[model samples]
Target: MSWRRALKDTARSGIAVEKKRLEPLIAVRGAAGLAIVIALSLWLFGPAAAASSAFGAFQAAIATFQRSWRPRPELAIASGTSLAVSTFLGYLTISKEPLFLALLVVWTFAAGMSWAAGPTIGLIASSNVAIMLVTVTLPTSVAQAAGHAAMMIVGGLVQAALIVLFPVRRWGAHRDALADALAAEADYARRLRHDPVASFDPQPLMEARNAAAVTPRQARRRPAELHGARGIAERIRPVLASLADPAMGVPAEGPARDRVRELLASAAALLDAAAHAIRHGEPVKVPPAALATFRTPDTGSILAGAPYRAMTRLNTLLQDVVETAGGAPQDGAPSGARGTARSAETDDRSTSGRAPTHPGARGTARPAPTTRSRPTFLALIPKALKAMRSELRRGSPVTRHATRVSAVAATGYILGTWLPLGHGYWAPLTSVMVMRPDFSQTYSRAVARLAGTVIGVAVATGAVQAASPGTLLSGALAVASAALMYLLMRTGQFATQACIAAYVVFLLGMGGEEWTQTVPERVLLTLMGGFLAMLAYAVYPAWETPRLRTRLADWLAAQGTYAAAVFGSYADPSASNAPDVRQALLTARTARAAWHAAVARATAEPVRHRGLSRTAADDAEDALAQLGRVAMLLEAHLPERGATPVPPAARFADALRESTHQGAKAIRERRVPTWDAVREALDAWETENPENADKVVRNTATLVLDTLTELSEALDTAVPPMTLDGTAPEKPDGPRNPKDSATR
Candidate 1:
């Protein structure tokens, strides 16, 4: 490769990195409106007035940032409180450097660690760095400090007003969430086309659904998008799994196969169409006659019996999606967006496994349990503080991250004080913002921050030169620059950092700070901060990937407990404890969430030290997902309607309990577990009766055990698959499934 060619390749790669979207017309108008407002304000108000108002305007601009799709009162309050408190702290400590710098370290640490509390609190804590710079070092008097604080509060209020008035970005994130989920389902459908009968992993699409659910959903879009996609997929997965079972003896590559293939392809197309419509904000456009394929016996039709039952349900789900696009809940449907979704995954989780969670494979679930009442507004403070205290006590990764951030930021603060720069606070601010709990995120931010600062400094200098007619012109230019910054902020972290740098430059320039002086100082301080943050991470980092194996072990242990608790419910439906079952599910969900988060962080970790290969990691993650699926099924499935409630047989119940016990022991002890009663029961059930519904339940139970066994063996923790009641143990070093022996 020639040097010139290499350079060209590098340039091309850089350009391709940013996937620019065609901005919606409304979005463009919103940006223009913001620019005009800022420019006009500066032109009308003198520089002092404009600069003072900016403390409000800048914050207002940021209020409409990532995932802030709705009017969240708690968020508004949190933001206001953070800004006020941070500014007050700065004002109090400006003349007391030793005290302030020490507090800065502690404050930053808390901010960094607050990520454990979820996105909302984390955003609030992140405001501390901004206050440290804009409030603490700059505020000259008590009156000025109070005045600036009031103005900033007003700015946040203004942003909230704008949101209500314009409503341009309403449900934008919600729309994307639905579109992404549908698109992921479509992709999964495509994969299924090649292997119509085989049991492929459903983790990727499952994950997309999980992520979509985690977002703040609009109440209106919830019912259609929530349970509809994941619920339908979960329902369909087992139908395919059961159909693929060799015990059923359904021939491959027949008329049924061809019909199933067309249905799957059509399902994929339908999902694609829905995804397109949601993303473009158009009504779902699918033929109502599309249902006729399942409704009538046609060419290449497999519409009969259980498959037909599933097919009809699929049609109903499609109708639900279309209705969602049209707006509001249809007749006989659950109200609210996530209400039905809350039950979606939990229902039919055990359909693939008859672990007593769903022996008859019935997928209907009771309504979601009512949530605890919301605390009064004042109670939020105590609740948040209590959460903080609890988070600190746990010697978990969140605690460690908080400690790292505090130490690094404090060091940066001290450095700023020692160094001679026009605006030394930028160093500590950079340190605080650049260092993140996520290792990959931290590194990326550091790089972006540096590049953005350099670019911003240059841009600010040029703008100042071009627009410096007087104070009014200077202030107007600054406001215009701020609007430009807002336009680019969410485009990418790199773009955001660049815009922030320019915004700050232009903002200070309105206060009569010369571009030549402020630009160099700003760039230098930013570079120092970025460098310091990177160095700190290199010295004392918490790598999630290295700890993934341990987290997986914890997940497996939790799964064992969850499975045991759920199976106990199956043993005697009359004795089933709803609260206990719910608790077990919540535990499993927590464990599952933790393991997935760890896997994500590990994948994003530096390649040389990422620990696990992507393939191995994905397999582990998928196995965990399968376990969660079974757990969900157990929670959602209920006893058959009007049937005499007979207890699950001792043989079945004992095997389940023992299997779960051994699985847990293996994960904790790092020894492979051997099956005994489980194998015996499966063998007896499969061979004894071939044409009973009870036999199907036993087969499902066996399938679930087989999957768990495979998962355990994959981790090299399984001893063998042998009868625990005196049969010679067959030890296998690698993973294997129980033989599909179906002799009738």
Candidate 2:
């Protein structure tokens, strides 16, 4: 049903759903490329060295998937270096068990703890696996070990070739994120049209924002382009939220409502166009009539004041989006407004500073892409050393996780070596592969690893029985199987390559003298490895249950800060508060991202000896999500009080201040606090300033009140104490889900 809906939506949207359609084909093409590389290498090296070269192909395939999301040039560098380094380390350590073991502990510890530094560091650590494998081949001949390690590099080169020669659309992730944000806007618009009284969830839009910011690879290669789109996306969030405010009366009904919805739909279409434009480097075009209503709003409709304000902001932002996306003025925005918006965008770009190491992917472009000098290798050494020191500091997640991973790997290796299967490498391999920083990912991957093993074993055994494909065919098939795994890796279907990996493993082993005894031993070893990884995590968690509540508090404080900023902005927009607003939003985004990470851990966490149950944790997550929308609404519809006389700004500023404090206090105290002060402030403001209480101001006050009430309910919902034994202490733990009581 979802697929059918997706198809219908794609057809309705008029743009080709190319990414969704091309994933499988990309997988096949990438696999084919890797296979060709391996096949050619095997031919050159001969069957005597097939196993060695096949290992290279395996590494290359894994590296290809790891680096695939990045731009072509960066992918080449990272993937190439990773393969070479791991292979070099792998070969150098062979026949030296003590050295191999030492390297294993150090590398695994480094990899597990590397998350402290950042994404790129973390990626390098997690993906480098040759060192561990090299340890397993202890007591092997130097020539044989070197040959296999060298093959890995050759395999990586093949994968790189495929990316360079037949690259799929670059910036698919960025495009998808932009599309998602636009979709979110459209959904919000539709929801406002139907029911403005109900609370909304900002999670979808937040997820989109998070995805774009998750990596900065695109930023490095094309900061000017990608950041411009990101800037537009971020800037538009407030405007959309404002549109949702009932006070804005964007489209209560009639032609005005239709025009508003039409504009929103067109905005979504514009996003689609921008996405395609980024990929193809073409000018983004929109229907000339698309945002006509937004460009020139109704004169005497319900959109007189607030909607007019919305329409004006929309004009500014839409023009800015088109300009940054290298799009044209096809949306029929006034020429004067387009120029103004472009200048505004440039001003933002000029003032926005770049991030350390990687720049922010905020979707807002600066006046220009500054020519900041890239840090040289020597320059980065100090920072890298500093980061290492920080990670090794007592009780850091990185340090704790690293120590845990090292211990587990050592234990797994010892157990494997003691088992007499001579394939003990499988245990440590599984242990290293499965153990990650977060319990959720660790457990999930453990399940995937085990499931994939079972499936791969079954499929490989059947293939072996079905066809004796001879030496050449088996070797080629092995490379192809490795390629397939890399190809399907990014699809998030972890099991997609299980069968292929299994096929490669079985096929590679078949060439050896002990071929008959290989499959069963491998199956057993794989299971052992999976069990060990899962158990290690259970014994020593990288993050505790209490951290979940701590993260939630962080999010609560973040929203409180944002709300306070929004309130202050509403009270006095002319004041130099732009930096405060921007910083507040950024802080909130960071906090939200952290909370999201914590929630993910909670989900993947072992259910026993934890903080809140899944249901309670989920409720807390939902509450925060709802609160985010309200906070955003404040930012969006915050009435400018400098030049224009927004009487409501003065009326609700104190109320908002009180509410923000109360809400944060409630979240921390684990109790629902009364918002009597907010109501009192509102009452006093309205009573003292009756003449200022125009319909618009009154509606605005009502909106703020609704938000506070929702905030109160959110804290109340999660405030109830939860038992550790999975039983409810008092009432049924919160709601079954946050949405059950969504309508505050």
Candidate 3:
């Protein structure tokens, strides 16, 4: 081979190798960002310079442990006991023989508990053990070391007690908040059917749905509440099912159950109708008959008897708003209100020779859509289930991304400990906690770490100055400083507060070393740690944006297909196959969740892939919003019930299928094709009338095209062309991913 060719090959090979090397290092760097700051603080101040640093670490560990402990009391007792045992064991191992073996045992125990019970317990127990061992070897006198250990035990006990007693009252409050939020969501959904002005943003609605669905499960621990709600839903579910059935109509035996079910069905229908109206930007008309049903005393009685009274009230309010919007004014106008004046004018006109006339009243007044002739309860259940499933699936991407992050953190922690960097033990710990793939978190951690180190230095300097050089007073101050550091660590705003307290105690304990002598060294070490963390995070960063975009495209396609099926059924009553309709609805909901996940991933990692930044993500999200609007519009145009209508199912399916396919193709290519071409293609597909087999193929093709277009736009903006190779590249002299294929 020619030397020129060989050189080219060599350069190409080298680049590939470098890329591979950088991948893992990037992950490590991202993870290590905070650890570097902590390490720098320790190195600059020296272990002895910040005796309180140890105490701060201990407190931070305990706080983490407490958070992980499910159901407060068990966590407190477990964390406290573990802390005491680990500290005592660490002290014994350091002061006596078999130091290495003893350390191993403590390490193993901490690791096991951390993995099994949760991070909070493991961190506290491990830090205590590590600190106890380190203090034994420090230049401090045995008596001084003993005093420091005693304070840690006391602080741990106090923290544990506090955690157990109060147990962060927010959990229950959050549950209630979630419930209220869900209630609001249901009301909003109901309003959308009738009120054209009501905002049709699905995000808040989706959030509330997810919250309600999940909260109920979480609150299930409160068996009484859970059972009560479940019982009501269960009882109402069967009755509603019976009423929704075409053959059975309404059940005659259970009057109350039948009535409640009818109301719920009516409410659901109203919500569906509102959603349709909002999507189409058209006014919703509430029939006079529907208003009459609500005006009855029985309506209030039925609503009051329901498990979710708030939901019922919200439904009623939404109906009233819709009625008003439709130009049909209801009773009980506010005193001296304009509506009352209008009513008086109408009455006066009726009494005189002329007839009452209003510009708003154009269309003929019709009775509200009746529940009497609606489909049976069983029919609606499948549709509801489908919607619920779709909503749940939307968060899958976030869950996956979080899982990956946590796994990386756990691995980094284990590796850092195994490496056993002397006097640099905190480096790995800091990195794991601080480095996040998400830029916002990464930036926050880095800032906090830097601030903490600076404060720690200042505090250490002051303590050293006040205590005097090499005095007993210095040692006492060190113990007091440790306690103070412990307190600061609990606040959890920034790393600097705890660092300040820790560094001050360390200096005092170290016999009041001159502040001028050690400040620079501490700062330098901190910088080094930060650099290392950055390297680890950047080298082989795992970008989740691309995957998220792809998932969303698939979801959108599914929703489009479902919309087509619903529309198709509307066109042909003979195609009264409810199962297909139900499945389509479910598919649409799942698509909604996928879209949400994609948005969330983009939001979290705003700078993941070059063009796939926050801006791109937002654009993709906007497109999804449009798609949802389209789906709702199609549903609204469909006939309520009758013979086959215009826009057959086959045509709708073809358009949606092409749209989805196009979206997926776009993502894979990382290029957003002009959606106009795809949209035209769908329109053409719908225009062509074909046989059943041909129609299915055409429909599938349409969905594929649409998906491809959406996917392309989303991915093109999120994932950079260079990073599309699905591999992390290495950089010179950088920590890299061990798992890189090129390395192998």
Candidate 4:
């Protein structure tokens, strides 16, 4: 990537139009609310007050449109209250330039730091600061400022009331999220039928989990179908993978393979049916053949050992999915008692049921899976504060963004005020709206803002000049422009900016500004603000390209920890000192997410990937994904607590932990790493009596070795790879058992 290429890519992205489904009903509702507020304000307080108060309804409506799980009314009220406070506070300092400038700096900095919480919070906060800069200028006296503030609250209230009265698809987002997760699982099952090793992206499941967290107020009113289905979906994914995977003891080309495929196809069909039912809030119509496939006793005879157990688990789980998604009440009765038919044989066998074992093997209780309680809205404040405080370090991207944006904002305001432009606030306002934490968004938004302002300002000014509409008609046009903006909000930044620009023009016209006098000032000031924001980013960019290697290393380390934890459970099934598998898995997920986000951001950056090429990055991601998948498979079969311990696994787990810790450091230092310790551990385990070893432990260990070898090979392609002592790294040995190799 070069400067020229980066600029070209971002420019294209800036102008790209997305095809999105229009929410006509929601758009009309928002527009109607804005119209009602405008009408009342014009009748009682005239144009200036109307102009100031209109922002409350407009912004509150925008807040409701954000992809958040919080209730719409809550978002509206929060947005309105925050805007009113900002406007009221800004009015008190408008009398003195120094005081107002100081207030502006502190406020903008806090808004920048809000990004640590999340994008939704950050955007809403930033919008408030920009709105404050404009709204504060509308009031002349303290009493007038108070009145404007009160009207802003009223505007938010009006929008909230309408939403409550005319609700459209309550819990729609939650239903959609859950449905998407189920749909993704369905797709994964279909893909696995052709290629059992196909990768599955867990992003949809992660989003569903986020949506599942609701405030107590919401939980009381939530639909029954939304409950328990997500957990069942999570359980189904691993079972499907284990059943399809040949390494789990199913033959690649035999009757067993056909059974696996048949089971996969049935699972896919059932999952699709469940997804459709949940998404559309309809009755679940399980395909008779799909249910019959699960009920067939022939499946148990075709697949033996691990595959057989997986089949049994799948049958029971599918019944749960059908019942839960179909909104059937969950009583203590068997799933067969519910609407969906269940296999009598599968129903009698518990997943953790006692089975005939080897002479020395022992059974143990499974550890209870941990669940996190979702925090309430009020409870999240302290968590947000903690997150913000953590990002105060110099190296944090959020901190850098805060510093860069604050500086740009202050400079833009000074230049805007010192220049001859009458409406100087427009300059800094544009800068505030355009800037973001990353290069792509900031540059793209800058371009979008300038173009949209030109087009928007032109159309509105031309219409005003031609129609010569008075205050009443101007208010109507403003409302119409806002409605258009809402309708096109998700289409692209270009259309959004255009509507916004036109809306502003009409709003100011209602306040008695001549189009000829205000038009040139707005266009020029917008260009000035956009350029300032772009220049600030170019000078102080927080490039993710340079950090790609670090992100990869972090992910690798997290994977190693996860693998070690699963192995530790096998080593000492009853040992309280074993690492928490749940916590380890969570850490790995977070690291993987961070790595993906970095890659996405880096792809948009102008700088060349310093250590990793595009192909190398993709390969590395694939290897790591495989590594995580194998670990997840092992986790699915982990020995229960107090089970007979495989002592050799303890040494292997220690070796894995130590070797990967060293490997991560070697990665950061730009040197290829060797897995000599892991190889030696495998060799030692093989040297011990081969026939007496636990088969499950033996097989999964070899899979771990294979994945690690692939990971090492992937990283070997890094640009300018280095080695220690002028020698290449040692590769981990393959499966110790020849039979294990055949199964793999």
lDDT tens digits, residues 407-434, model 1?
7777767777788876677787887777
Clashes of each: 8, 13, 111, 0
Off by over 4 Å in 3: 1-70, 73-164, 167-170, 176-422, 460-464, 467-522, 543-617, 629-662, 671-744
As for TM-score, the candidate ahead, 3 or 4, is: 4
Worst 10 residues of 1 by lDDT: 348-357
* Candidate 4: regions farther than 4 A off: 327-372, 574-579, 640-643, 720-744
Per-residue alpha-carbon lDDT of candidate 4 for residues 322-371, written as tens digits (9 for 90 to 100): 78788353333243323222211121112222221332231112233222
lDDT of 3 at 260: 40
TM-score per candidate: 0.78, 0.77, 0.46, 0.91
- For model 3, how does the per-residue alpha-carbon lDDT over 1-744 read when each residue is reduced to its tens digit? 233443343233322211111222222221132133224434554445234333433443334323331333333344434444544454555544446444544353334234222234434444444344334444345454444445444444444454444344324432333233323444543443333223343343333223223222244443222111111111122222222221122223355445544454355554344333332334555444544444456654443322223333333333433432232344542222222222321211111011112323311111121111222224533653454344333234222223333343334334444553433334433443444434334444544655566677776767666765463444444444444443443345253234543544454345444556446544554444444554544444444565665655566566656555655555463444344654564456667765665565344443444445566666666665555444443332233334434444455555555656665565545544334444564556556554443333344344444444554455454654332465433433532221133345
Cα lDDT of model 4 overall? 0.81
lDDT of residue 35 for candidate 1: 47
lDDT scores for all predictions? 0.57, 0.57, 0.41, 0.81
How are the candidates ranked when ordered by lDDT, highest leading?
4, 2, 1, 3
Instruction: Show where candidate 1 strays beyond 4 Å.
Output: 1-17, 20-49, 68-77, 197-250, 269-284, 298-305, 324-383, 466-469, 557-590, 606-619, 622-639, 643-665, 668-693, 717-744
